[model samples]
Target: MKLVTYRHNGKTSIGKVEADRIIDLPRNDPALPDTMLALLQGGQDTMARARAVRGDYSVPLSEVQLLAPLPNPSKFLAIGMNYRKHVEEAARVGVQTPPTQVWFNKQVSCINGPFGDVHLPAVSDKLDYEVELCAVIGQRCRRVSREDAASVVAGYMVCNDVSVRDWQLATQTMTVGKSFDTCGPTGPWIVTPDELGDPHALRLRMWVNGELRQDDETGSMIHDIYAQIEHLSTAFTLEPGDLLATGTPSGVGVAMSPATYLRAGDVMRAEIDGIGAIENRVVAEPV
Candidate 1:
């Protein structure tokens, strides 16, 4: 079942994706709840209800807006250099790959809708784009075992971890470079865990101005998603609606021989197999 959180007519609601259009779940259903977070918090019972819901709502998908699947995540964790090609490219740029996962916080304030626009911040001319597969946690987990990590997943979504290279390099930690407002763009649709078999085998790709930049399969990931989850859960409790932006593959603009970067008016699209694509345009930040 593909689940989605959408807004129409100034009201936001949870719905199921069918035939590329979201079918509104009845608010009075005994099993399903109203909000995506509530449905996730309800666990399997809510999912079961979401699966069974049928028929239509008042709004057609064309009239509605798709928000971040989980707008306010308990934790917005991102993995860095988890892809082998990305590692090699970083090395080519004189960046070192850490022995362990380079996890960083992408503040929830940076979250934007699937079709939203991302700003080419005036503060930094080194803006870049990262196409990634993000996992949405469905259950509360602590010290989670790698063997059982898949069970805690709610779904997957396409994400663009937009970065400002200058701010990111200024700090030892990458949060400042990563957490600019509107930096994290995700959605189009969330493919439920049941339908998106083997998260590590899917293909993720990204394009800038209609040119393919990053094109690689998740099978190329060095540490892999399960290991990333197991490693992260060991340090902190993973809760429902928590998001994990599993690192991007190689072919980023900054890694180019001439080091290209995003400019205002450039449109970026990131896509993952089974999970739909998300697109955003680069625009100048308001003065």
Candidate 2:
């Protein structure tokens, strides 16, 4: 089932998306948690309950505004240069490949709705797009082995690790550039593991306007999701709702020979096979 956070008829709630409608969980059972994080922390039993939801409390998906599925995650993390071609492209831009997983914080404050507009920061003209596969942690645990990593992940979502390149490169910590308001766009809905199957085998893509830009398979990741989970958990506990952006592939605007960054009015779309897509138009940040 696709888990979603949606707003309809002036109320927001965690919902189950099916066909062309969204099943309102809170309306069906007030016992259900009201937020995605609460639902996830409720663990398997809560998930089972959400799946068994059956009622007249559903609305056409078109009538609801979809928000970031896990809008208030404890943390939103991303792995950098985890794709070989992406690593190669980074090297071209003078960013070196790491000997170990290069992890960064996208700051939870940056979180944006699946279809929300992305801001072109007034401070920089180097805005860029990176379409990535995001894993949402379901449990609070540390030092997880790669073998057990799959069990801890709640589900997956498509994420756009929008970057303000100049600010990102101005410092070793990319958080500033990556965490600009509206920089992190994720959702549509969360596809639970059972529904998504093998995440690494899916094809992902990015487009500007209607032209294809970044296209690659999750299989191209140099460090798979399990490895990322194992590595990240080794450093700290990964709590329910924490997001792990697996990394983008090679065709980012920065890697193009002439460096074609996003401008105001540009539209960006990111999607993964089996999962759905999210499209956001770029608008300039207001003073």
Candidates in order, TM-scores: namely 0.96, 0.99
Count residue pairs with overlapping backbones in model 1.
0
- RMSD each, Å: 1.3, 0.8
For model 2 the TM-score comes to 0.99
* Shift in Å, residue 218, candidate 1: 0.2
Kindly provide the TM-score of model 1 when superposed on the true structure, using C-alpha atoms.
0.96
Q: Write the per-residue lDDT of candidate 2 for residues 1-287, one digit (tens) a residue.
A: 89999987788899998899999998998889999999999998998999999957899998899999999999999989999899998899888889999888998999999999999988899999999999999989899999999999999999999999989888988888899999999998999999999999999999999999999999999999999999989989889999999999999999999999999999999989999999999999989
How far off is residue 244 in model 2, in Å?
0.4
Candidate 2: what lDDT? 0.94
With a 3 Å backbone cut-off (N, CA, C), the pairs that clash in candidate 2 are: none
